[model samples]
Target chain A: MARSDDEYDYLFKVVLIGDAGVGKSNLLSRFTRNEFSLESKSTIGVEFATRSIQCEGKIIKAQIWDTAGQERYRAITSAYYRGAVGALLVYDITKKDSFDNVQRWLKELKDHADANIVIMLVGNKSDLQHLKAVTTDDASAFAESNGLSFIETSALDNSNVEEAFRSILSEIYRLGSKKALEKGSTSNFAPNATQTIVINPPADEGKTEKAKCC
Target chain B: MTDDKTLFGVSDGLLPGRVVRLGKPVDWASILKASQDRERREKEKRDSSSSISDLKSSQTSIPSIKPKSKKANTVIEESSSPTDGETETGKQRTAARENSSSSPSATSSEKLKQLLAEPTLNTEAVRKLAWAGLESEMRSPVWKVLLGYVPTNLARRNDTLRRKRREYQEAVNQHYDPYLDTKEQSVVTNSSTYNRIGNEEDVTFRQISVDIPRTCPGQALFHIPEVQQALKRILYVWATRHPASGYVQGMNDLVTPFLFVFLSEYASVKDDLSLLKATDLSVFDNADEALSNAEADSYWCLTALLNDIQDYYTFSQPGIQRRVHFLRELVARVDGNLCTHLEDEGLDFLQFAFRWMNCLLMRELPFHLIVRVWDTYLAETDGFATFHVYVCAALLVTFSEELQDMDFQDLVMFLQNLPTESWTNREIDVILSQAYMWRTIFGAAPSHLQQAFQASY
Candidate 1:
């Protein structure tokens, strides 16, 4: 039996950004659909998917925007970062250049995303251990230096894929609840508060889903 | 490199020297002619036994246009009648067909065959006829001519193909083959300079290779190694030649229809092309020269198609941006309720229609329907760019009722994964007809779209 994905206590807009062919799309598919494909096409423009996960006894629906990772496409993909509350900066461990380009992707987030966006540094393709180019300690040190949470994942073999998403969603939830507490607005924590961080509120009829952030 | 750039009139300042070599002008007219004769003989021999049955099957398989009620016919004539004075004969023919009981598909196919059979093809007349739909038997040659890959002059067609095909092969050799050889050799030698050059080329090559298997993954033909190699070479060479845009992802999808259409000319199957399989490689076996010719044609035809919408793939992709903007405005004007519904749901046009504009709805519609849609797109004066905006608006409005019932997530998923799998020619015809009607109405006025169109030109 599937839980009602439509009924959620919160909606978080997360973006997946990285260098081309670093498995950003596969990661999104593996997380949202619980499926993966080695033959997934290189993403063009952007793709969207959503999956609801339980956090703090509440349903947190994750709306993930999978953007094309090519350098040129940033002109278009960056525009989608405006209201995102979280980001997964992914790179293939088998490719050194993708790891090197992590700084550039971080700069892109700084330039386009919200100031409080929770970013996770993901070194994907952990299944390709023999060909690993970016080691865990190196990426971890880099993540620490940049103040970004770090995780290694294999969207191919399902290793750390679930944990990576759940960890980020929980981190975002913690930050949001802390902010709500700071504001002294217990209403914000109510089940139906509907105080969405992004876009306008939903109509009275409730026919349209609210495009929201944490 | 400077000399090569000067020779080719390309002053992009970004091209690498070794990748800029132009093919030496070759006199392959005799070879091409001989091959053409052989192909004709083979086709004739193949067709001789099945010609009658083939004709009978084609006639039956053609989705006959259902005779509309008198009122509907009048509305269609009023709305769809071509306004161009140049297409007077075509207009009369359309009118005559409305009055008569003649099958429009057979008539259009006959008209296309006649136009193509001309010593000097009348391209404008052919476009008018092909806009409705293309005859399966004549689509290959007609598409070549319409795309300008082959010449209008019957005498120059062979020579043009020979030169273009040779140029494509040379381009692959210059840009692709040496890089692969060097990469393999560099693995052993560990030369830094070779590594640098290999890395620069590898970015595009790797992306293309990763995408080739993914392009039309459901279609077995793309899974064949030989077919994948051909597609890779075409995309790589195109990317190399056009460094400004390089290899974009959606381009991989764009190449499929052309490759399939051109390769279909050689396959034993014709009527039900969806039945073509990866095991059908037997047709291409030992036919390297013929296969390469098909590959070259696909390259040039794809080039011709992309040339009109080059901005769609360039840095920033301003072409797609403008078209997406146009779609939003067009939808707002055409169906204000649908537009308000989407806006109220916080569903930006870019969120859903970006793929529609980027992939030319290839991601939305199925393979076969897309080819049929391309018939009108290729026939359009702008080669599917501006007219595509209107088509997208029409498509969105087609689903307005269902879209209004959904929210942002459902709308995005529904639009992205439209229930177009079961769509056939009948549904496509309606979409295209509505698109044409919208273009006719909104295309001429000095509206917002007109201003943008003028600025773009």
Candidate 2:
């Protein structure tokens, strides 16, 4: 499972961040492993998992980093945001406090993450409709104002979990391809620049990119 | 025996004359049944007239038969267990009798009993004995002294325990009661009010509640309602008292080893905690005083542990950062090739070693091995902070060959999910011995590691 796969067309590093008990870890597991446990342990440091999804006719391997959602963990978790190309800002629907903390989480990403990192504001735990405190309209309006893509997912019922990841990966792929095109155009555009658009490609390119980012 | 050879085959080069004994393959079903039968007999005796004498005789005999066989029994229960209802009384009796005579665990239990029985507890002697490894039956009281939760003088031990336990209960009432009662109302109010008013008590309570059920998700023990409530109260009380570090995420994992060890004091079967059913925990429900005592011990021991490594959970967690740095340098000095291989693959020590230092490898190893590891950690001079870096270096070096062959992603995943789920005492003994050897070599001369790193470059 550790071996690098040459088969992926692109690899996007995404992060999951939110307040405590907001289902960030469950969302990561539900998306990456198609597994969910009601009693999943709170992520202490950071957890890493990878899954390949078909997006825009390309295999986009999403390397997801799940972080502890406690406020104090930002000292360590913020570093993981440095090179992340995307982020899933998650919040529980039943808990108004988690949803209200979305603004803080967004400011956190703005502080630490890349300027162009694609973000999707995810209102999770849609399964608990009766106890819901945050409405879809409020979260949607919040996402729109912040210029982030929006989705409501239930990692428990497997609702919109896959689509949530697919949309974000596809958005990242679009932005990455655009960035590669612009870079290629200025530096004597090659005919095969499309094939070289893999984000943080392995070997020579991977080494330099890692050194620069990390 | 052949299976044991293939399973825990690694030799401990650091310790001489330490024979790693492999008892006959454990029959968990019969053992479980035997334990249950023993519980029934003990209960029947308690209802009878001669309960005290029978209890004393049974306690002495049970430990002799139990410590060795039950040690192996827990490893099996943690990893995999065979089907029950297969009565092998003959084989079970033979294995139990052979284990009592042949297993070193029995002898260690005897030695610990004698040492702990001394009027004035010999602190150094107990530390040395416990550093080797603790038998399940002896862990509770041994840990109480080792962690200094109980006084060394036997005359004052009970008084000290009563006072500390009462203080803990008071702290819980002062901090946790308001949160429990006003939890819904606080949620109804804006969360911004919490930040503005500096009422982190609500936030800390929420975090602890979320983490309690998640503490040991796989184990039924933590899932018991009483256990979960106790954990929440312990963590919440501790966080409230220590404002500087106030309830970090990894502190939840630190409490489990203590709770498991201390709670064993109340169980009928001391060796294998896995045999304990949720129904058995009813004792705690009925005897509220006993339950509170265990909770108080867990809280105090956790406080004692975190007191030594307070910086690890402080704002920036500088202690863990420094430890991770030291681990990297130590690994480079110990195994330059593996260190270079990791750097070449873009693997930073913080990427993996942070969790190792944070949870003390509790996340990587299974519950049984973690308890065994803590037997040594609590015995360390600096309370496992300085010595733990050496252990982390030893663990990395042990996997040097396999880690060198993997890529960055593979390395992180492999290190995070180490294949130690099925590890028995044999593997743990080797790792602890290796950790001790490295600590002895590099622990005294701090400059030796720096000089070694510079020379390698």
Candidate 3:
């Protein structure tokens, strides 16, 4: 089920989702590539990048998926939500409406992503503090009520860009390691196949009993 | 049509005008302010209600950040830190839109924003006003020094910084005060939140749907106005200079930093990655629809740039060849022999420089810092072919000593797996500057750079 590093302690898949101009691509570039642009082209399709991180001597590789945030493109991108352990739901802090659309994104996650997906709510473009509409307190409180992790950062200033990824990677690692421990001894996850295997009673048992009785 | 030479203040005619329109946008400030006030009050009213407006731009109506479904909230809570405080917000942008259409401020701001976005349609006043705003930015010292004119004298730097701060303060004040602001130099803020019915939402939604965020927009010819104009002039120059491949789609992004640099005096503000990407925009056009609208001259200029890149593209597209060649440049700079050694491995070349050649160092560094790297790339485009290689060297600098114990595969993975926060500008500068010095010492540089150094750069 894993590639690249079973030798390592952990691996995580984090998907980045947001509106086109809201800077999801820029945020991904800022995280995976460490680059930002005042003028960034809107994203076209899913772009994935991998980077291994050292967490307390255990190396964790982040399989980061950058998805198109456009409404129509979600049809193609919806397939990407599967198997993801983490999602960085990004929105532009300067644009209030983008901040408001977080619920729909969360719903989309619920519908498509794993049942236990770790979500981080990022209000991007923190460098544009002068033009700030969404306050940190408001976003934080919202996160509190909805059970999502929150951080307001500027991809431009490179603020908290690393911490965001680090926390998500480790969280995924913790979960994956726990799952590994839980299922490592018993083979892989049953996916409900356990019931089918455990009750594989002889189909001819009834026929044999009838023959004996006769 | 305004000629490029006069437009750029270039009397010698090295840069000609693209005659792009500079129209004034309608003032959307009042409506935006009113809406902001209303939103602020709404926040004050509920105190707990978090509106997801950004969602509206990407999603639709009355976005509630809370996932209404328990299954949604459960997955989030169980998976993340109990402290991961970010909540779900849903934008009822459509509702706001309905209300905005009826609001007087909304109508006017929308009109103004419309005027500003279109380069083809404009009133003459708008043109003068547009040029005036740009001109004002030209005089604005903070960004003018973005060209990186750091004064050697601490006193002068302090003076310049102070003067810039004061001027920014004044400009900001003028932005607020209608009377104090000259009609000629009005800086519109809170511009009516772009009053297109579904333009912002549609555009952003379209972008996200296709997974554009995780990928490169491939040279950014669409969004930036300055970039569009720069492509236009380069198109003109290409028509006269290298007409075979003039004005290709991706070329605009490549020239943007140069346009900014050409406008500035010292070319000091270090955002070389942005500068580099801007120059590299001429590589190819990914969006065919966008190409239909582009000027013919621009297409040709782009063609010329692409022609030299024929060899690399013979396999596919030549734009990426620079990624590899530039890797050589970066490695040679870091430890001339080390990069060469790695490259000579030959058989599995992809094993070592795949990431470097792939993302162009985009995956390695912070956004603005990339811009800083681009600033340098713009200045020395030929020698500094691959900008990210410097980023790679910065990440791997410790490798020289630390990795002496590790194998080559580990080295490549370590370089590939490096984190953004690991390196710094000082580290990069040390490598790049050394690379710069190393090259010039061996007679690789043009005399102009030497002259510039002699004159005290």
Best by lDDT: 1
- Model 1 B-chain TM: 0.75
Scored by lDDT, model 3 comes in at 0.43
A161: Cα error in model 3, Å: 1.2
* Residue A153 shift from truth in candidate 1, angstroms: 1.9
lDDT of 3 at B441: 41
Residue-by-residue lDDT tens digits, candidate 1, B137-157 = 667887887665665555556
What is the descending TM-score order?
Answer: 1, 2, 3
What DockQ would candidate 1 receive versus the native complex? 0.41
- Winner on DockQ between 1 and 3 is 1
All candidates' lDDT scores? 0.70, 0.70, 0.43
In model 1, which runs have C-alpha deviations exceeding 4 angstroms?
A1-3, A181-214, B1-101, B106-110, B181-193, B196-200, B272-276, B447-449, B452-457
- TM-score each candidate: 0.79, 0.79, 0.35
List, residue by residue over A21-92, the lDDT tens digit for candidate 1: 889989988998889988777787788888889888877878788899887789888877867788999999
Name the TM-score of candidate 3. 0.35
Candidate 1: count of backbone clashes, pairs at least 3 residues apart or interchain: 0
**lDDT tens digits, residue span B194-236, model 2:** 5432457777877887788788776777777778788888888
lDDT of 3 by residue, B143-177 (tens): 22222221212224445434433432343333222
